[model samples]
Target: MYADLWSFALSTYARPGCEAACLRLQAQGADVCLLLCGAWLEQRAVTVTAERIQALKHIARPWQTDVIEPLRRVRTQWRAMAQQDEDLAGLRERVKALELDAERQLLGRLEALAQTWPIGNAIDQLHWLEGLAAEDAANLDHDALQQLRVVVTNA
Candidate 1:
């Protein structure tokens, strides 16, 4: 296991099909950073609880809404225009990097909150993913979730 959430996320995201799966989940209204953190917690055998889920969400939601989403919106808004303009494309790339950095910061915050929590208490680690997923769980893509779980476990 990677000792930290960010390291685990970086490695897990690099695994084949992981990026696509995460993107699909994100499109379905799931918070990708939270899901990645969920994967990290699961890999570490951390027990899931309602309180713990709320704690992580508390740390993630604001930063995501205030910081990451705006960066993402700007980068996405520029996609088509950037395709035609080299300068816009370069600016878009920079925005993309900022978005990534924002996510990293969010992950760091999440780690700071959960790092002290005990691990190896859950018999079933899947709870972290399920708990952190969208409120309308029925809409979530099970295949993508499963792929993420498989990759995290394998890693």
Candidate 2:
């Protein structure tokens, strides 16, 4: 049931209509949570308090592992390679290739992560992925500068 709820939320979030679509999806997700919570409370024969509801929301927010470690390692390796290369012409192409490949991997990983996040704010999750992408891009820019310097000296 949770899986179905999450899938619906994600699809609804992705659909392009207007502001109304987003509102509708959020309402549906929250309603499902309420229904599940109600059933759980009824089954347990316990009164649901505000704190209990908050706890349910917390559980629903599902945590996703930050995917920065692999990206960090890739960036560090690229930085080292850029610093060590003497010929810019030969290494420039390779450097560009590395950045391109890293970007591709980053997007794929981020999208995969989004799919796993709980059914609250997939939009916020997407924004967080964008943050990781932006930060990674900056690291690439710095690495490229180091690479260019090595190239200029050898040329």
Candidate 3:
């Protein structure tokens, strides 16, 4: 659930010309998926005691590196873009078109980078695509494009 929602929010928030909007949302305290995931882990611990809490924290520490750090990286990029003076309209338009042509697949390039994902976790595999440059993902192969179909339902 964190993976899916985070993946969806990541791409939407990173729209080329929407940096200001993304920052606004973040400032309002959204995109705190890590916090929610952490809470979930804590609650699911064997007991609601100090030992269980410590154990949950230990289990979740490594995940913070893999999952939380990616989201933080995305937030960093969004802040940088939000502060830039560059005009991103044209680039955004180009990305939309390319994404459309590729059948609205947003995760294509990232999937290619990872080569493949575990069985039954296809949608979550898109988690690797957060904060990426759309231009960098512009060139995708067939399998990558197929994986991207996970982003846009109608695609």
Candidate 4:
């Protein structure tokens, strides 16, 4: 288990298939911060509840929408042109870093919010994932979710 949320998120996201699962869930309007947090809690065998899911969502949505998404939008908007333009490419790289920083900040806030929550004696694994993505859960890839579960659990 990670000592901090940022480390956990970084390691988990880097795991094979986790990125695809995140992106797929993102397309369905799920917040990656929440997903990462969910995974962190799952790893620690935290008991997930509807109230907890909402709390995480409430804490993450504002920063993700206001800070992270704009940086991501601009970086993505310049993707094609950045490949051809040296200056834009450099700026785009900076934006990418900024986006990552913004996400780290969000994770820090999340860590602060629930750092005191007790770990469960029995892990209700994937309950957070299902709650966070309940509206679009059916649309996501089962295999990718399974891969994430395997990686997270084994971590």
Candidate 4 structure, TM-score to reference: 0.91
Compute the lDDT of residue 56 as modeled in candidate 2: 41
Write candidate 1's Cα lDDT for 98-141 as tens digits: 99999999999999998999888888778899889777889999
Which ten residues in a row are the worst by lDDT in model 1?
118-127
Best by lDDT: 1
Clashing pairs in 1: none
Candidate lDDT scores, in order, read 0.92, 0.34, 0.34, 0.81
Error of 1 at 97 (Å): 0.8
58-139 per-residue lDDT for model 3 (tens digits)? 4444444455445455545555464563454444444445433332122323223222223343333332222121222334
Candidate 2 residue-wise lDDT, 1-155, digit = tens: 22332333333333344124223322323222222233223322334344544444343333211233343345556665667675643465565566445434433333343334344422322112112212233333333222322322232
Q: TM-score of predicted model 1?
A: 0.96
Q: How many collisions per candidate?
A: 0, 0, 0, 0
Q: What's the distance in Å from true for residue 1, model 2?
A: 26
- Pick the winner on TM-score between candidates 3 and 4: 4
The TM-score values for the models, in the order shown, are 0.96, 0.24, 0.26, 0.91
Question: Quick one: ranking by lDDT, best first?
Answer: 1, 4, 2, 3
Candidate 3 — which residues are off by over 4 angstroms? 1-47, 82-155
lDDT of 4 by residue, 100-139 (tens): 9999999999888778788765455567766765456778
Q: Candidate 1 vs candidate 3: which has greater lDDT? A: 1
